[model samples]
Target chain A: MVREQEFLYASGRIRALETKLLSRTIVERILEAQDMDAVMRVLSETDYAPDFEELESIYDFEKALENSMKRTLGVIKESLKDQRVVRFFTLKYDYHNLKVVLKSRILGVEVPENLTTLGEVPVEELLKLSKGEKDVAVPKLMRLAFERAAEVYEETLDPQQVDLILDRALYEELNLLVQDIGHDFLKSYLAALVDLTNIKTMVRLKYMESDLRTLKKSLLPGGSIDLEFFEKMFQEPVPVLIEALAASNYSKVVKDGLENWVSSGSPAVYEKLVDDFLLGMLRKGLYKPFGLETVVGYLGARENELKILRVLMVGKINGISEDMIRERLRDVYA
Target chain B: MEVTLGQVLALLGAAMAVFLPGIGSAKGVGMVGEAAAGVVTEDPSKFSQTLILQALPGTQGIYGLLTGFVVMQRIGILGGNLLPLTTYQGLLVFAACLPIAIVGLLSAIAQARAAAAGVGIVAKRPEELAKGITYAAMVETYAVLALLASILMLFGLKLA
Candidate 1:
């Protein structure tokens, strides 16, 4: 049995670590850098220097930053002595790897050679799974997940459908485990994640004019909305769908996105709006009475920070002016 | 002389009164702490602001403890019993603990979540930290009110 006290102690260590997030001033400094070399000079003063030095191009720099993040995350996970929390994070990586593999197979794209491999199943195992000849050890370790995915794959008889099913199933299983921990902090974070993902998928489906069956298949099972209610709302026209969602916590920005999508016949802005809203929500929700949410919220903020950095760095390298980049930047809370 | 059951029940109510709010505050703090840690890992410079943001939901626990203390005082544990009470009278005091304890516990957790999200906002847009706090405090108001009512009831109760 995991000792709750140890978890709390580890959480204290995490608290100390949270004192290191980049400030707005730092972000601004990085934004003002004239080139990638200048950006690297600024980054060298911070903890993000490890992979920042390995890049030959803007694209390479972004990839390296992503790799560094994964590596740092791996190190942090190792430092955590609490097995359950470690397992929870590992499952997240596992899901992420699974998604990448499935996407590569379906799109017939080559798997990136430098893909981070921190999940228990390993990169080799994922590669084998992608080739449709699952290895015994990996599948055994992921038996329940593989079985569920296989069942969905068989029933749907469509690769895309199978992928969607697996995604939803993995999220449900992970969320159930989080709930069983009985930590109120984890519960709220998980709930918010589920809601965000469900809403994003709903909006995407609406944009695609997907059939009802496909839309239903895309929705995750354990969001704030009941399946029946979600299906009903999803069936409405796009404008009505926005109106229905406006009643929830995500109203302000999502409603704005819906209006934009209706007037312009483009969902791009709405997609960005959703991202901003979720990021904003996570940022605000994490700081109070600090615990697990703080850790997760910090991780999310770091991801956004990196995204912003990458955007700025690329814009600078491509000779895009600050004004253009600023105009294109989505509000963090929109 | 037999010690009345009313006194025993009142004692239990007082204990719950103190413990429940404590639980709520601990839970609330834990939620926000997790979020803060995650943000700090990526960018540690936002530490001061994040700490402030994460600490906001912890008031519920403090409020709960205060209510518990007030209840204890009213029952004469801290002073002389001013009135004689029947078993049903003690039950009313015990029942009063529920609204504050339950609401305090749940609302603190929820408010912490709102605060966690707010912290994320601050990390990205430091200018909007106040707005985020306002949103988080919106959830905290009900829990505070519940705690206040419980305290008021404990003081108003006339033990006879």
Candidate 2:
């Protein structure tokens, strides 16, 4: 199929789904729901209920919501059957599965069966791969990642390095795929990914006081930050770092965040600021002529909603008050 | 007969006008896609909100293209040549492409970063994504204005 035709079909399906996203009023009503069943009912009334019957409990309801979303997304992926978009989604799962497996193996922690299988690759296979027992193509495919991560492990044994390597490798692979496809939406999406990753890395390094070399090594090279500027920023004191960021495109947001961090002396504010900055960008970037944008955007929104739901659920289970939950809630954009 | 420097510059300007914004938008939107995928994997239901988030970075390319089309018309590349071929004319065309090209390049990428983070927001708080998108789009206004100014300049050149 022609790329344009695939995009048209995908966009059409996305439009249908987009129509069903909850409005402020609907979200408010859901928030006011007295119980899980009421919330489920609210969800069912909307377009999100296709797989609702599969739920067996409140937890099941959440799981089913996630699963249904995956199913729907899978359907959307089918629209791009001729393209590598499906592989893109599958790679995400692969990344997640690899992370879970590696973390479990390195920490000598037992892997939860449910947690293991949630991403692209099946949990069992991931477990085997983690144990160095699997000779499947995945290991070969991830050869670069394995080698890089091994080097990090040998050097510092910092599990974070493993994460950093995986993230960098996955992004590199994803970047190549996006470039090959050359769609406007996909390009923007990948760029955002790089930017966010950089922000996250910068924030973590800042908090940890890790040197520029370590931080630089951890970054995915193709991001917005140039190596020279990144090094300069890293060498500067925290105050200087904040000032440098404040002078750039991220100035206003980062400045405000820095002020808050200074006043509160809390790193959480910075983390939240990073979150806010990236979220704000994604919301505006997807409206133009790209079917992939819509699909990808919907996927993002769904994830945010789930995170909020999970927070709310945990609060409910713990008997936390709504007001407390409200206070604890990070700015949605943040 | 040889192509004058003036003619070469005009062509270069027009080409940049067309291609630069396209590059910017492509980069911007690609940035957001990564975040969107991550969000959807965690929760598929927030798709609509994430779509809006991802769309924020795409405007730079549109603005760039609009400017290019207008410049083409002004240069008589599309129709009539109202302006005489002067070094100044070439310079103006070159100048006109600069703001959109440079801003389009930088802001589009910046917005893409914002979109990636926006995806995270959607994943964690889908209902609040509109505000996030608005914030991301704010940066593109300057690029749009720059493109508009270039088009206006072309119109003025035609009148002159």
Candidate 3:
């Protein structure tokens, strides 16, 4: 395709860079590293980063990791021929910051420390918009979500509604952006992500034995499993609903998770498996070689790598067991 | 008016041999340059290695120029005189140029993609630059063969 040719160089560079991604063996070694010092030593071997030599504590390492993530995002944005794709990926962070701001405002406190500063909107502007100040500088979608979330929080005096409002608004805006982009592959990827997110919500609510109305309210529409379609599936029991997912790409994950959930009754494994399934969806982008897929896929890979490292490091700091830390690790990109 | 149709044909053959492959090589080299620039922007240490890969796609232009030069000399155009070529001989010359003209254009561009990809390999792993060059060189074989075929045909052309 002409699109493929357009991205030939960027994709080629990414392919080479991907070869240097942390291998599963290396990640395993890092996880098996006995102490934080040992872990940081193994991390120093990889590009886990260049400036983390001063990282003595988990907080220090997080800051370093956050900086690297910001740099990587900027690099990937610069490399890609399409900035729209990056903008679309950035929407999630804006929404995430929006949520943090709302929570901070609700608590009548300053915006929490280490709230991710990875979005298009600055923390200052997002906080302004979250406080229901009329700031035209804030993005329209972000402002809309913040105002709506704050209004609902005021009405119900429930923090839950704020999350529901923002999440729904996030997906609604993301799906619209995806449509505007008009790339079928991305559309499919985002659709699959939406489906996974909806499943995550359903599983969480189902395990909590929350009311069906709450579950219905939490459900994000516009996935392949539309809200209209899911309304029929909603009335079914959690196990049966999970069984329905067996027909989807998450068949193995849902089935295996369902088997485990029966004994544990906890959706933890199910949630992990589903998160992995989402990454698996992103993994298939490697086959495309040239497109928005490689750029977006590498971002996903980098994000997953960061997440695993954080999990491993935090688990170490908290004196958690190896198996517990390993259980939470996402699949490695390499 | 003094130039015969045969002379025009022979000149066209020379032009085709030079222009098509030159354009192909230019495009190929430019593409590789863009890729190499990106790598160099990230890591300046890879400049020498990427420069080598960037030069790979440029050989087709030389082959094209050589073919064009030989054709022009054969017709005495470069020598400042026009040969009185028959229509058949003109067609033969035109046919001879086709191998390099077509293949050189295509192979150069293909080689450019390979060379650019090689620059990527060099960017990430400088030690693997040779392997990347080998990949780019694979696309060079067809261009060489095409040049050989064109040269052989041109030399073997019987002027009547």
Candidate 4:
């Protein structure tokens, strides 16, 4: 009872912050805008207005988006009593930067793009760690995962192995983090994320006509659905997999995602459905009066909003048709 | 001036009436204040609106203090002549304080949660502040009833 009340301030702040989230209508308006300038105009009217004002150029949308993400996350971090909740949201970025740094080191190439500062570990520290410098303290889990992924890539000579190893390690760290936090809601959320990703991988590999060995290696552990279930479903056709999934919680997601995949010959719709499903799960925090749920849910919503903005901006820059961009658009939390 | 067992019990009753609900109200009001501060941090214009929600939980403490004040008066702690309460009468007074003391403690916390939720409403929909207050006020009804029961019991005691 006492601990739950600790979140009252964060819950109230998130509730207010929720009003600033872009609605589906606003996303559509951004989409309908004739040019990038019109998109900027649409965004300028929202909370992103302040972010845009500091931009060096109208095209520096990445800086604006990253600044906004960093600021929103900072707000959440400051308000949260349990910093582990922040780790739950941010651990991914650390793993992401690790992947970029380690892979570039392995390939002997210049780091391709900018490392996100959103990770719990700073980019500068991660870069130093990649250079085999031990001066900076990094999380033991990430350091071990990075070394292991590098070793696996060296042995297998497969870049895919790097991703699989790091991805598994990422989930492992998330699993440990949530366990330490000790919330059933967070544990279930982690399970769902793992389960959904495993399912997506299984479907994609099936389409690739990959061997069972490849599928076995790529599937992540700690999901509610065991490996045996994926192996069993892997042999059967897509329809049978759909039939099997109907009895599980992901029945609607699989059914809709698979049908779209079958019709469109693309996984874009499935990806979108997966995001929407996760957001829907996070939004369950809304029903809870006060707790970590609202805080985590708010973070998830902010991330989703950033993703939508990224897609819109990327599409506009590339001169993709609005309809094409709309096809790939995921649901907004607002 | 040795304190009699009866006087001790009567004093215990008055202390419980003041402190238990007072603790509850402090917790309740603090919770609402935290939530209200969150809203005000985002939009300072909502400060007055959220303050109203913060005040809702505070009534439980006041109700408790009122019950204590009446008990003090009845026992002559306020009137300057401590009543020579019988042990049975002291027990009765102690029993009377229970309704407000226990209820005030629990109801104030409950009302604070409702009022904190009202802060969320004020954050998003400032126009519906009344509805938020109404929900919080609903929790106040139980606290009010408990206060009334304690007051009535204190007044009905024939301590003369």
- Which candidate wins on TM-score? 4
Instruction: Enumerate residue pairs that collide in model 3.
Output: none
Among all candidates shown, the one with the greatest DockQ: 4
Chain A TM-scores, all candidates? 0.79, 0.79, 0.92, 0.94
- Put down candidate 4 lDDT per residue, A240-282, tens digits, no spaces: 9899889999999999999899888898888888899999999
User: Which one wins by lDDT: 3 or 4?
Assistant: 4
Q: Can you give the TM-score per candidate against the true fold?
A: 0.60, 0.59, 0.87, 0.96
- What value does the lDDT take at residue A101 in candidate 2? 68
Worst 10 residues of 2 chain A by lDDT: A1-10
lDDT (tens digit, per residue) of candidate 3 on A249-306: 7778878876677688776677778768777878866655355677778788888888
Can you list each candidate's DockQ? 0.05, 0.03, 0.27, 0.77
i-RMSD per candidate, Å: 7.1, 10.2, 3.1, 0.9
Error of 2 at A143 (Å): 4.0
Q: What DockQ score does model 2 reach against the true complex?
A: 0.03
Residue-level error in angstroms, candidate 4, position A189: 1.7
Regions of candidate 3 where Cα sits further than 4 Å from its true position: A5-20, A49-51, A54-56, A110-114, A131-135, A211-213, A284-291, B41-45, B84-95, B123-128, B156-160
lDDT of 1 by residue, A1-334 (tens): 3333333323433444444555566667777887767777888877677677676765677677667667656655654564454455557667667766665665678864435555666777777766767444564435556556656666765677656756776787777677666666566666767776776677678778787888777887666777776678776776786677777887876788778877877765666676676677666424443444444555666667666776677788788987766644544311
TM-score of candidate 2 relative to the true fold? 0.59
lDDT of 4 at A71: 91
